[model samples]
Each structure stands twice: as structure tokens, then as C-alpha cells.
Target chain A: MEHSSTVAGNPVHDNHGGTKEIWRTFWILLGLTIVELVLGYIMIGVESTGGRLGLKGAIIILMLAKAFYIVAYFMHLKGEIRNLVMTILVPLSLLLWAIIAFLYEGHSYRNNRNTYDAYTRERSNIQSTDKKADEKGMHEKKRTGAETME
Target chain B: METTTAGLDTKWWNGGKSPFNVEYGKLMMWYFLMSDSFTFGAFLIAYGTVRFSSNGWPDPNAVFKSYPGASETTNAPLVFVSIMTFILIVSSVTMVLAVHAGHERNKKKVATNLIWTIIGGLAFLGCQAWEWNHLHHEGAWWGSNPFANSDGTESTDNFTNFFFTITGFHGFHVLSGVVINIVMLVMTLLGTFEKKGHYLMIEKAGLYWHFVDLVWVFVFTCFYLL
Candidate 1:
């Protein structure tokens, strides 16, 4: 509907050859997508269950492969300028690295909280025992297994 | 007989082919789509990272659902999305045919294919509407400030926030696709593209339609399948 026949900006092409090549590219993309779906499902499923396949690693690999195919074939990035691909990939890589860092930090924070809770409980128990002995109005020595053995 | 030249002509990339045809709008659209893909890709990647980091994320079969009226259990599975996937794929096929007809200079076939494509787009939108309402009514929203349930109970956890935002964005795109298809259909009826003897508009629109389908495939994998 927006056609203009000025031919000022028209890309000259041997339409027959170009069309055939593009069609072939389409078929190849379709085939790759099907393969990806099948393999990706098996990989993700096995990984989700903590199986031998190292699910997370496998998923990351397959996901990258899928992204590569889509960008190269469907998005025509394969034939595009080098700078264009870098423009897309650099930020993506940085974002992924940031996510990994944040996740690890969060995990460590949870672990620290657990450790603190354990130590606090141990100290409270010792204090409570000492207080109970003091309430009896006797100089009750601390129950030491080593003293008993001696 | 024709005379032969002693020398050959040389040109830039695509070898003297059109350098970014403005009228075709193909190159411009490609650039736009590349940027758009990055946007969606970032969302999906962030989702993956969050899901990976989180402890005890819900399983797809256990979480996302088909309605009880449609299925037999609380875990109705991704059957609704599966149907929507098929509809979108079918629409893509019709769109391809429309583009083909445009190349062939077949106006009647172009119109028919456009109509079919529009119908498919509308069907997808309807399905999305249903899925969204179903999810909302099922308390899929983020809970209270402490992220607790309204009744002082613990609800499903916070990863659902990412789920709703990403998928909701995609659904909004689908809604717009429907509107765009309607506009294209109306333009077709007005004979705007009829005299061109080529369905350039359909070709451009197919790029868009296919991109949407392509994005969904990734979303399906990232959100539901994984």
C-alpha cells in the first residue's frame, strides 16, 4: 500500500535467484527450531529434577544455541554488519553477569542468616542454664565433661 | 548478437544491489525488529536469571493452568497456551500465503489470505483475554506488602511477579497485533494495495507477524516449558 515507483532507492536484484536463496534459508530456520524444541525439552526436564545431566548447565547451553539460530537466520544478523551484532551482544553479556552476581550474593546472605540464628540459639541456651543454677542459691559449678572424667 | 565488455562492474555489499530500499521499508523494519527483539530477550533472560536464583520455583504443570471447565484438575497444564500457539502458527502460515499471493499479482487471493490472517489474529486475542482473566481470578496477583495472602495466609510466592509482567507485556503486543491486522484489512478493502500488483504491505506485515510468533516460541520455552 505504501509503494512508490521512483526507483531512487530500489535495491537492484536478480529476483529469481535471491528469492530461492531466501526460501531455502526459511526452511533451514524452521528445521533448526524444531530440533531445538525437542532437545531443549529433554534437557530442561532432566535438569529440573536434579538429575545427572547438570540441568542448569544444559539449559544455558541450549538457550544460547537457540538464540544464535534465531538471530543469525530469522533476524538476518548473520549477514549484517559486525558492529550491529556487538551492539546487541555486549549489553546482554553484562546483564547476564550481573544477574549471576546478584544471585550468589543473595544465596550467601541467606546462609549467613542461618548461621547467625544457630549461634544465637546456642548462646541463649548456655545463659539460661547458668541462670537456673543461680536461682537455686548454690555455687553450682558448670557441668564440664572433662572435670567429671578427671 | 550482443557485444561483450572487456571490464566488469563492481559495487558495495549485496554487489550493487539496492542499499536499504526506503520504499520497500524492509531494511528499516529489520532494524526496528532487531531493537525490539533485544527488549524481549532482556526480559526473558532476566526471567531466567530470577528463576534460576530463586529457591523452589513452581513447576509449569503445577502452576499455570487450564480452567476446571476445560480440564479435570487444579493443574490444568498449558493446554490453553498450546491452543493459542497453534492459532498463531496458523496465522503465520496464512500470512506467508498472503505474501506469496502478493508476489504473484493475485489480488483476490491476497484479499482472501488477508481476511484469514485477520481472523486468526482476532482469535488469538480472544484466547489471550480468556487466559488473562483466568489467571487474575485465580489470585495470581502479587499478595500483600509482606507478600502474604489477604486472609493472613501464605500465598504463592514472588516469582509470579516476573511471570505476570513478562507474559502480560506479550499479551499486550498480541492485542496490538490484532488492531494492526484490522487496519491492514481495512486498507486492503479500500484498494490501497490492489493497484500495486504486489503485496509489499503483506510482506512487511508478515515480518511483524512472524516476529511475534518467534517471540512467543521463546516465551513458551522460557516460561512454561522450562
Candidate 2:
């Protein structure tokens, strides 16, 4: 079977290689995932919030790297025309602001709740005290009733 | 090899050809995937917002400890989920191979790879179903969280709410991808692309499958790992 080099007068680059690059990418992705899993295991032992945040930062970086590999190589976006790449990426940059704003708002919400919402503050305090009594089983039953009010 | 003077001129937007140099269908597929990423981004970001606002959250390690056929008291963490993650990654590899085979115009290889990809999708979904059932049995649902926070305080239902919603959405995507692959496989057997002289359809389907895998990478990191 013969095929044309262009579809609808648009040139399609013929960059096909036998499974070499595919296997290479597969290995890279697998290795990255293993590293992530190892880090997650280590995180179980880390108690400090700062330390856990740092490890989580590392995991997020690894996750982005994996995403880059999949989109660039597996999806073949890297081999595409520059115009196409830019169009897709430029719009996605908007997510940066969205993430920052939303998380900031959430933090402020938590702060507000802790400050002004006496009912929630009291409830949480009571729950923690109940936890100290080793009455978790009993508290669990009572919490079901509490949840209905909310 | 046939480059017209206009093609050499770098006037990509001059009106006659695709500026991206890709066919209309594939270009549209790229844009579609781009928009789909935003939808997923909104969901994960929403999840993060809720997590940030909550006073306490459940530890994923404690909740997702048990695996299939393990005793009820098993304490394994990140084990079964790691298996699910690998299944997705391997399926994504097969999808890449299938796309490559389509480029080579090899019918049998494409069919074989697609079948492997489908099996991988189903396996991942099966693992998810079992996990959900186990969690449900433990009194976790949209509005109920039986697991306490890592600090031993009561946790809000948002944890399980986002968990089930995001993962369920992702699982739905996988199911649809599997259905699409089955359709592509049948079309390949019938020599539809062979008659059409191009396997561009397979390439588009491959893009969707990889997108599903990509989304899982984020979901797994957000919910399971961190």
C-alpha cells in the first residue's frame, strides 16, 4: 500500500523509528515513577511539615517531568510545527494564576474559619479532646449525628 | 519531497495550507486534548483548594493500605496503587507502539498492541473497582469518612468526596478510551484505514489514550502519594 506524503496539501513529517525511542521513554517514565514511590515511602517517616512539603515539592516536579515526556514523545507534540506547540502551551500558562489564587483563597478561608467561626472551632476542639479519651469508636458514632446538622 | 515555492516561503498563514502542517482532524484533536486538560486541571485544583481549607485530612497511607486477597488488617501502603500506576504506564507504552505501527502501516502489529492496551485499561479499572468497594465497606463515601485524620482528629467528608469524584472521573475516561480502542481495533481488522490509505484515526485514538494516562499521573500524585 502506498500513501501520499501530504494530507490536504499539508506536509506530514515522516520521523518514524522502530520502537527504540518508545522503549527509551517507557524506561524513563518507569524510573521516574519508581523514584516517586520511593519518596512517598520515605515521606511516611518524615514528621515535620517543612520536610514533608519539601518531599512533596520533589514529587510534583517528577510528576511534571513525566507529563512532559508523555505529551512530548508519546503524543508526538515535540515533532510538530512550532506554531502548534505554542498555541497549546500559551493557553495552559493561565493555570499558574488559577492555582495561586485558589490556594490563597483556601488558606484565607481556613484562617477565617479558625478565627470567626466559633461553632466549628468548638466542634473541632471537642473532637480532639474526645480523641484523647481513646473514645474514637464512640466519637465516630456521635459524629454521624453531628454531620447531619451541617 | 515536493516543496512548492510557496511551501519554502515560510508564509504558513498565507491561506492555502495548514499552518501547523498537520491535517485538520489531528489539529482539532490536539486542541480538544488541550481543552480537556483544563477540565482536569480545574478538578484537581478544586481538590487542592478544599484540602487547603480543611482543618484535618485523612492519611492516604492508612486508607489505601489493603490490597486484593490480603487480610483485613493489612498495612501495606502505596503497594496496590503502585501496581495500578504501572499498569497505566505500561498500557500507555502499548498505545505508543500501536501509534508507531499505524505509522508503519502494519495492520497486525497495530491490532495486537491495541488489544494489549485494552487489557491494561480493563485491569486498571478492575483494580480501582476493588479499591472502591473496600473503602465503601469501611464506611467511606461521598458524605461519610470513617478514617480519622493523621493527627487523630475527625476528618471532613471532603477527602473521600474529592477522591471518589476525581478518580471516578478518570476511570470514566479510561472506560471510554477502551471503547474507542475497541472501535479502532475492529476498524483495523476490517481494513478501513487500509482502504483509506492512512491510519490517522489510530493516531488520534492514541492521543486520547495517552491523555488518560497523563491525567492518572496527576491524580495519583495528588491523592495517593501526597
Candidate 3:
């Protein structure tokens, strides 16, 4: 990210107070983004499912932190009145609740779908075998032997 | 304005006026933004659900890996997206600077910062357009994702659908934000706010711009990082 600093070695703060804070946030956000990229890149190399899951969790945590910084700093919500802050934050938690519920629901469907597919495949296999047996002159001795024995 | 003798006994739910000093326009902006946030939040949640249900997802790194002057085979993940992220973050910086300038009544600095922000917004949109086009030719389309389907079929996986919808919605917001910034720039140059002796307009616009950036933060996480 580009910072309007006077020098690379100088402190981020300039004579202007607010401008300094903005640049500091700019750098922090940039660094976090880079860390996210690095973690994501490393996950590409993780072959184990458990390792990949752990990395995904870590990435999500980092992402949430970055989100907090962006909203609090960039959007200036940190300095807002407590009432205004709660007005936005209180209802937002419902969104997180919705997300978890839907994910669980979707996972349930995934499990059901596997069994459904297997059942359909088994039924089709049995039908095809029956069709082949009927196509041939095969009933073993069922038809004639039953009638003669009777 | 009618003087209300009703005193503090007035019902808290009375809609006559805002009890707090927050302006009507600013308050309305918040309400509108909350609704917008809800929409984006739902889109993201939908994505997460699908992501959870699927056994394997296309790695965002492998899918969105492109950089300026990068080789055709270069697989560095998120290089282009990082640039996009920086563009947005810088734009937010410029936006806040513009707002600060407005507060100080520094017309020159306000105009300068606003122009820089407008430039950033335009550049970000251009990058998105290029990315969409590039991905389109690479077998990623609104209907299908090349990575999502094993047989390279179209219209099967929901990945491309969510991807296109979410990003397209965000791109629309960016495009509108650029337009709004341009108008504000022109108005500033024309001394509209100067004649009025206040630049509250710029501050409000800055709020919307910042909100747009906030939404991008989530989108970046969902689409690029996660």
C-alpha cells in the first residue's frame, strides 16, 4: 500500500495528527492482507485434510480481525456514539447466526445425498441384471419343474 | 418549526424529530446502509454454506492468481487481488483525507483528495472489468466454474453463480461510488459547498465510500482470501 510518509525511516506520524493515524492503519491493513495471502498460499501446499482445515480456520480468524480493523478505523466507527454503534452491531449478530444454521443444514443435505445416490445406483444395477436374465431363455427349472411337480 | 410543549413526557417512539443531534440525512444513510449490509451478508452466508457442504472447493489462490507482468504459468496466489485490495484501502485513505479536509474548510485539499479518491475508484473498477473478462475466457462464467466441475461442464456447480452475483453486486456499488465522487468533485470545484459555507456533503459521501470499502473487505475475504 502507498503511504504518504516523508521518509521510509521516519515515524508514520507527521505534524498532522489524524493523517498519521490513517497511514498507520493503512500499513496495518496492508500487512494483514499480506499475511492472509501467505497463509492461503501455504494452504495450497497442505495435503492433509486436517491441516487444511486448521489453516482455513486460521485464515478465517485473520480475516475477521482485518474486518474489524477496516470497519472500526477506515469507517470511523470506533469513535462513534455508543448508541449508534449498538444500532449497527446488535442486529448484525443475527447474520452470523443465520450463516451457521445454513451451513449445518447444507452439510446435512450432503450426507443424505450420498445415501440417495447409492440407493438409486443399487436399484438400477439390480434392474439391469434382471433384464439380462429375462432376455435369455433362463428361469432355471422354476416354470416347468413347479408345474410337473404339482 | 412548532414549539412542542410536550416536554420529556413525549413517548420515546414519537416520530416527530430525532431525539439525538444526528441529522436526518445522516440517520437515513445509516438505515439504508444497514439494509445494504444485510444483502451482502446474506450473499456471503450463502457462499459459506455451499463451501461447507462441498467436499473440495476450488482454491481461491489457484483460481484467481494473476499479476501484472506475470507469466502464463506463474501460480503465485492472490497477487492481482492484493493489488485490488490495496487500491481499495488507499481509496479509503484518500476518502478520509477528503473528509478531514472538508472539516477544516480547506477547499483545495478537499478537491485534491476527492480527485485522488475518484481516480482510485475508477482504477479499481477497471481492474475488476479486466478480471471478469479474463476469467470469462478462462472457462469461468456466470453459469459455470471451470474449477467446480470435474468434466468442465457448465451450469452445474453453484460456485460460479454466487461468485458472479456477489462480485457483480459489489462492482455495481463501486461504479456508483465513482459516479458519486465525480459529482462531488465537480460540485466542489464549482464552489457549491463554499457558497453554502459547509462541506457536510463531502462528509456524507465519504461515509458511503467508506461503507463500500467495508463491504469490499468482506468480499475480499470471502472470494480472495478464504
Candidate 4:
């Protein structure tokens, strides 16, 4: 029986598309990042909720594209056998459910807060207060007894 | 029975071989990275949940508008972060080159690329440190947020809390990756792999380095852009 190491040593398994492929992946990743940045920049002036969400969605898609190139080319996952690829990726699909569930729950929580949590709603509506003053007041309260000891 | 047994024997998972056609170490590294991805996924998803639950959040453009040597009044956003993102991408490219050199058994190329990758990692860390320092001066920390919501309404500390925690975690990963690369470079210089007849260790390190870069892509999109 041949050892697994011997099987892994087969030169047939070592064809990982060489340096040209690496450079190509580099360019693709760089391009995707540039697109994402441009989309993000354009999103700044987008006022409508739908418009802003659309740009954010585009940026997210570009970000995922960048991730795909990095994983496929740089990490050499694309060169792996089909079984290996499936094993790594199939489990990752669970993240879709996790994301959807969490975001839904969070959205519901926000709705509940807005309706029932008067303090939260009131606080959120207030104009921005001087946070430094709040921090100073908290510090002052903490220092009341310490000053006498010092 | 003979035909069925023959088919089974020819399968990659026949008792004598690795079904993945990869050595145990590399396969384990892939599994480790998969698990690590979930960890980062959880952090980012939790961040998303918090943002969703909030009524309003700080505009990333307003918060991340400063860069090194820029005037305090300069109103550029996403500029410094874009540079940081490029540094990471370039470092990831160098890491691929290092791994490719490892494949060719070209020790000199491996060492040089590793050095470049290390430099890129450090430069990225330096940028993060500067950004963190700048934010710290403005009173953003784990439990404090000085910035207001985009609508000029009061904002919650969860903004800075998640930002510091997630990015801090990602920075820690980059720091470890640099250390791992330095170790690989030292081993290469010592001809450790030359004696062992393989640079598989460098390939593993490269996987880890690239994983750090991969996490940054999501982090940049989530915190800075969205």
C-alpha cells in the first residue's frame, strides 16, 4: 500500500497555473477593488434610500467578486480537486441563513424599539449632544472620593 | 463482486490514499481557514445586526475622512482606506509569488518575495495604527463614540464598539500573518525546506496570509463603505 504522502507527491497534482495566472488574478482583484471604491464614492451623493441601497448592493457584489478571485487564484482553491472544493464551500453556505436570520431579527428589534421603547426613540431624535461633557461628568462622579485620598 | 470491488479500489478515497489528493497538513490548513472564516463571519454578521437595530448610524465618510499629512480640514473619505486596501492586495500578490517560488523550489525568489510581503504587511499595520490613533484622539473607542449619526441625531456607542472590535481583530490576524511569514523567511534562509525537500510550509503560511487579506475585503466594505 502506497503512503498518502506518496500520492500527494504526484507531479500531476502540482499544476497550479503558474505565475501568469497569479498576475492575472492580481489584476482582477485590483480592478474589482477599484470598481468597489468608485461605487462607494458615487454612493455618497445618492440621497434616495433605494439609490443608496442599490450602490451599496453593487459594492457588496464587487467585494464578493474580489474575495472569489483571491480564494480561487491566490489561495489555490480552484486548483484543488472537486471533492475538496465542495467540502470547503458547502458548509460555508450556512452563512446565508445566518445572515438572513440575524438581519431579520435585528430589523424586528429596531421596529419594536421604535414603537415601545420611548426612551430609545426620544434619545435618537435628540440633536447630537457633547459627548465629551458626558464623559467628563462620568469621570467627575468617579473621582469624587479619589480626590480626598490623593 | 470483483467488478464492484475494483471500482471501489480505484476511487480516490480507497483506504490507501488521501481523497483530497492533498497532504494532511495542507488539508488541515484548509479546514482551519474554513473555521476561521466562520469566526470572522460571526463578527461581521453581529456588526450588521447592530447596525440594523440602530435607528441611525454615523456616516463612514464623515468618520474616516483623514489621512496621513492631510490638513485637518481636508474632507476626503475612503482615500486612506483605499490605500490600505491596495497595500493589502499587493501584499497578497507578493505572497502568491512567494508560494509560486516555493513551488519552483527557487529559494532566492521565495526569500525576496517573502521580504516584500512582510514589508507590505507592516506598512498596512502602520496605516492601521495611524488611523486608530487619529480616531482615538477624536474619542472613538470600544465604549465611546464622539461622532453623530449622519442625520445629526444622537448616535450609539455600538458604532465605535463594533468598529474597534472587528478591525482590531482583523489587525491582530495581519500581525500574526507577518510574524508567520518572518518565521517562514527565516526557515528558508536556514535551508530548512531545502533539507526537507519541500516548501509546503510556505504554502500554508501563504494561505493564512491571503486569508487575512480576504477578511480585509469584507471589513473594508462593511465598515468603511457601507
What is the CAPRI rating of model 2's predicted complex?
A: acceptable
Model 3 residue B81 CA deviation in Å: 0.6
- Which stretches in model 1 have alpha-carbon errors above 4 Å? A1-150, B1-17, B21-24, B71-76, B142-157
DockQ of 4: 0.49
Real interface contacts reproduced by model 4, as a fraction: 0.76
Worst 10 residues of 4 chain A by lDDT: A141-150
What's model 2's lDDT at B56?
80
Candidate 4 residue B66 Cα shift, in angstroms, is 0.5
Write model 2 residue lDDT over B55-106, tens digit each, in one string: 8877899888889999856789999999999999999999989888888899
Ranking by lDDT: 4, 2, 3, 1
Candidate achieving the largest TM-score: 4
Candidate 1: fraction of native contacts reproduced? 0.01
DockQ of every predicted complex: 0.04, 0.44, 0.16, 0.49
Q: Write the per-residue lDDT of candidate 3 for residues B13-125, one digit (tens) a residue.
A: 35543333355566677778888899999999888887666544555665687765665566767778888888998999999899878867789999999999999999899
Candidate 4 i-RMS (Å)? Answer: 4.4
The CAPRI classification for model 4 reads as: acceptable
Measured over the true interface residues after superposition, the C-alpha RMSD of each candidate is: 15.3, 4.6, 15.3, 4.4
lDDT of each residue in A88-117, candidate 1, tens digit only? 456557656765676676566545545666
Q: Report how far residue B4 has shifted in candidate 3, in Å.
A: 21
lDDT of 3: 0.73
